[model samples]
Target: MYSTQGIEAIATVTELRSKTSALIDQAKTIKTGIMIQKNNEPEAVLLSYDLYLKLYKQLEKSSK
Candidate 1:
């Protein structure tokens, strides 16, 4: 999972499983990714498609 200071939203695995649609909607509305935690540790991140593409492009450019 991507790590950065000041991440304001988080969800546990169980929460994500039960409220996938709602959490996704919230992420889109907030325009920020949600960090998913498992076993009380960060496991993955859920980012909107646009944001993922943007970050991917940035990484690609930086690696060039």
Candidate 2:
């Protein structure tokens, strides 16, 4: 399971639809991820591509 320790914001599915751009900007500005929720449950994370690549690289390094 992913940790929620430092998550700075959250968006519901409906809000995601209406505020996609703002949410994405928030994620980028934070240099972290924004949790996406559905039915009051966490369902996904919105993170910048740069951050995604960074995490992917870390995963590759740790798996080796």
Candidate 2 at residue 45, lDDT? 88
Clashes of 2: 0
Model 2 global lDDT (CA atoms, 0 to 1): 0.88
Give lDDT per model, in order: 0.84, 0.88
My TM-score estimates for the predictions, one after another, are 0.85, 0.88
Angstrom error of the Cα, residue 21, model 1: value is 0.4
Worst 10 residues of 2 by lDDT: 1-10
Task: For residues 1-64, write the lDDT of model 1, one tens digit per residue.
Answer: 4564555699999999999999888777656688899998888888888888988999999999
lDDT of 2 by residue, 1-64 (tens): 5567677888899999999998888889886699898998889989998999999999999999
Q: Which candidate is the best by TM-score?
A: 2
Query: What does the lDDT read for residue 14 in candidate 1?
Result: 100
